[model samples]
Each structure stands twice: as C-alpha cells, then as structure tokens.
Target: MNGLRKGSLVTVGTGIQLINHITHEAVQSIRNAQKVVHVVNDYPTQRYIQSLNPDTESLNHLYGPGKPRSETYRQMVDVIMGHVRSGLNVCAVFYGHPGVFVNPSHAAIEMARNEGYEARMLPGISAEDCLFADLGLDPGSNGCQSFEATDFLVHHGGFDPTCSLILWQVGIIGVGDYIADGRPSGHIGILVEVLREHYGSDHEVVVYEASPFPYPIAGPMVQRTTVGRLSEATMTTMTTLYVPPLATKADRDMLGRLGLGAPQRS
Candidate 1:
C-alpha cells in the first residue's frame, strides 16, 4: 500500500444524444479532470468532448472485427486505470447512461475502488429513458420488463406477455464479437421463433432506435409488424424490441384485493 499512488476516478455519461443530453455536473467533471477518456457512438459527441478538453482520448480504437467484446472492454478498463495509476484525476465518459449495460465503465470503477482510489459514477439519460418519452409509455402502466435480447433468449426468463416487454441489443443478439459494418449474422431466426412462442405469430411488435441527433428530428422507428415478421425489420446495433400487451385487464379479484373498484367492462 505504501508504493500505491492516490488517484480518483469519475465515470459519467454523455447520454444517447449529442451535447443536449449532457448534464452540467457531468460537463464539469470532464472539464475539471486532469485527463479524460471516452467511448461514444457518434463523431459529433466525440468532437464536443474534445472541444471541452483537448486532452481527451477515445477508447473506441480498442474495438475491431473478430475481437471479443469482452476483450475490448478489458482493454478499455486498462487504459482508464493506466491514467489513474499515473496519479491523474481521470474521468471516463460513455454514451447513454454510464452504468447502464456498460461493462468497461463498471470494470474501471471497480478496479479503481479496489486500488483504494475514490471512484464514482454519475447517471445520464439512457436509450430507455428516451424510449419511454418518445413511445408515450409509462412503465407504471401495465408494468414493463426489460432484458438483453441474448439473455432473454438464452435464459428463457419468465415474463408476462400481457405487459410491455423491452428487449435491448437485438441487432447483436447472438454475436459476441465486434463487426465493422455493424451487420450481425447469427441466431436471429431462433430469437424470432422463441418470441412467437409467447407472442403468437400475428402478435404486433415494435423495433425501436432512439435518435441520437437533435436537429435531425428522427423519432423512433416504430414498425408495426407481427412476431413472425421480426426478421424482416431493419435493425442496428442500437435497436431495441418493444412488445405490447395482448390481454386486456379484467381481474376483478386482484383489483378488489388492492381496495380498488373494478371498471365497467365495455
């Protein structure tokens, strides 16, 4: 412990969009840090951060075709820890919410804490946050369940088909490595088959991708298609599946248990 140097690590999110999603606190963290490292999806956000702090470095270079995403994440953690070890106040920025499904951000924070450094993560607007707004959805209404597409298929997680289901990372469903062209070629058919089991062949579903740019005014791609036509929908690395409820609510017993009166059936 005597030879160990004291450093601090702060992880923040730039949100899913450009500069508009960035919070004032997160902006201050980037400006005040001795060194800044980031991984973002688009060039505009990257340039925005660089403009705020010229010393900023991008970790996106670690990703490559055929390279395992896990390996790339580990490398990202190493780069962040490297600066922290150099006794610099390091700040790591990621797209969307830093702690939401970001392996490298979590790994770097854990490693920094283990090394006796003060490490913290700040929340930012995630794709789900945008989805709820753009889709006119309230999670409290009918209840919402979210899962990674791969995990949902592999584990066959118990979920209610009568409620809203959100599956993330659908475009890269079965792939474990990075692809330069962002085209994934694995097990999409299997995912569609599994979904049909619960949603039925004609059940309507939506493939959603939140717009990252503000001025472009690109809203979510709400494709109203059956479960069987899922494979035909255009998907991207950021695409998420939204499954709406099939059953209408008429549970009088449950409603009475909660001390609520039942509504008149139409």
Candidate 2:
C-alpha cells in the first residue's frame, strides 16, 4: 500500500463495437482512473482508450503462443493487482461484457476484495447481446440456453431441443493452451458426435460470429448445416453455434391434469 491511501479497482467493458458500445459511466471511469489497463481485440478500441487516458497500458502482451490460457489469465490478475497494491485508482477494460466468458476479470475483483479494496464490475453489451439484437431473437419466445462448448461436452449437459441453444467457444474446443498460429484438433468431431446424439445427424444448426465493426450487418456467419457437418464448417475463436428447436410435442396428459384441452396445431 502506498501511504495510507485507499486503492480501488473498477472493471468495465468496451462492448462489442469499438466506441459505440461503451457506456457513459464506463467512459467516465476510464477518464477518472489514475491508471488504466485494457484487454481488447480491435485496434480502434485500444486507440480510443489510449486517447481517453494517456496512462493506459495493454494487458495483451501477457498472451503468447503455446502458453496455457490459465497462465495468461493469472498474469492478467497479477497486473491488475499490482497497480491496486501501489494505491492507484485502477480501471481495467475488457471487450464485450467484462464478466461474460472472462475469468480474469472475476478473479481480479475477488482478489481485490480479499485484499480489502473496493472493487466491482460494470455491465456492458456482450456478443450474445448483439446476437439477440441482430438476429432478431427473443429468448423468451422459446426459451434459450447458452453454454461453453467444451464444458457442455465434458459434462454431457441435457438441453431441451424445443428451446434454442447457443454454444460459445466452438472453435477452441478441447484446446487447453493458446495457439496463435494454429487451431485445435479433434474437438469438433467429438462435439458433432455429442450433438448428433441429441439432435440427430441431419438436424440443422447455425454458426454465428458477431461483427465488432459497424457495417449495418443483418446477421453473423449463419451457416445452415447439419450436426454432422459442424466439424467441416469454418470456425474461429469467436464462433458460436445456434441450434433451433425441434417440433413441439403435445402433452395431452399434462393438459388434462390442468383441466385444459390438448394443444391444437395452427
């Protein structure tokens, strides 16, 4: 601790788009911080943060090819904590929702709190938020479930086929370490096999990736492929899989229990 001064940490999101997605409060936090550390994907967003705070530093340098992602995340937490321990007002920025699919942000906040520092995360629009908007999807319409691809496969999670499914990290399946120049191997095949069991090999699915830039894009890379073709599809770290619902099954016994008539097809 520097003197008796209190050090605080605030995590904020840049959202999916460069400048447009950041909230007014998030920007103010960046402007007011003594030091800012950011982890973002695009150059324009990084430049904007640098312009807002001249003391901005990027945490991206912690990442390396062949390095385990967990190691990189630990390094990120160390960097954030290092500034806070120095009694500086630190604002850490991450692209999209800081808490969503980001392990380091949560870890940093927890560590800071454990150290008797004021720390919290501010919510921002995530890729899923954009997906719901650009794709005209209402999760309430049929219910929706989202999961990490590898976790879903490992746990053999059960999902309702009548509800929509969104699988994130589809491209980096089974990849424990970071590979800057190469993609993962064999995970896609396993994913396909698992999905085929539930939805059948001919069941249609869509691969989606939200655009970080503004171009009035209607939808992501919506590939209409069967479960069997998932391994053959073009995918990236950002790719997400969308599986539409199967046919709604009538439950006459349940309807009768509720003193209601059976469902009629429109």
lDDT of 2: 0.88
lDDT of 1 by residue, 1-266 (tens): 65545778999999987788999999999999999999996898999999889999999899998999999999999999999998899999999999998999999999998888889999999999998987888888777888889988888557788778999999998789997787855677888888888878898888888887787567567777879998899888888888988776678898788787865432
lDDT, candidate 2, at 51:
91
* Local accuracy of candidate 2 as per-residue lDDT tens digits, 1-266: 44333899999999987698999999999999999999996899999999999999999989898789999999999999999999999999999999999999999999999888889999999988988886778888778888888988887466787888889888899888877754655689888888888889999998888877676654356677999888889888878888887878778898898887867542
Q: State the weakest 10-residue window (summed lDDT) of model 1.
A: 257-266
Clashing pairs for predicted structure model 1, backbone only: none
At residue 196, give the lDDT of candidate 2: 86
- Measured with C-alpha atoms, the lDDT of residue 12 in candidate 2 is 98
RMSD of each: 2.9, 3.2
Off by over 4 Å in 2: 1-5, 182-184, 217-219, 250-266
Best candidate (score: TM-score): 1
